[model samples]
Target: MSKHPGPSLAQHPMPWWRSGYLWLIIGLTLAMLAGGVVTVWLASQQPHAPVAAPPSQAEQGGSLEPAMQARNRTSSRNAKALGTGGD
Candidate 1:
């Protein structure tokens, strides 16, 4: 065999922290942990207000009549176009 040995047979192997891949993995994990902590803190600081329910048609006093008429007109037009005679 030659006097020179392969890298695997070296007397001292590289340390874990010195590895580029290890550093990359560690950095990504720390960044994700930081992001999660920030998100949780923000969520806790400003909780959403309770939403109010919308009034029903009767409660709103027939405000949707015009919209209903327009919807009926559109339905009849579509039915006529399809030769269904608008029922």
Candidate 2:
């Protein structure tokens, strides 16, 4: 046999800290990834709020109705003044 001996057993044995910590790092990375996925899912899940409807006729104190009536009256009066139709 050669003069030099083979490597020591302890030198090759896995270090205690590295073994557990490597798994811990893997677990934390997985947890973060899962959390990110859940966050995106939650963000996309919500429905949008509905748009407000326009005010009803009663809310405007009959403003539009009076304007329409005035317009009709003016049209009829103009028609009579022009003598283009019934007196």
Best by TM-score: 1
TM-score of each: 0.60, 0.38
Consecutive 10-residue window with the lowest summed lDDT within model 1: 2-11
lDDT of 2: 0.84
Which window of ten consecutive residues has the lowest lDDT sum in model 2? 9-18
Top lDDT: which candidate number? 1
lDDT for model 1 comes to 0.89
Task: Give a tens-digit lDDT track for model 1, residues 1-87.
Answer: 669765683667888778999889999999999999999999899699999999898797778778989999999999999999895
In terms of TM-score, how similar is model 1 to the real structure?
0.60
lDDT, candidates in the order shown: 0.89, 0.84
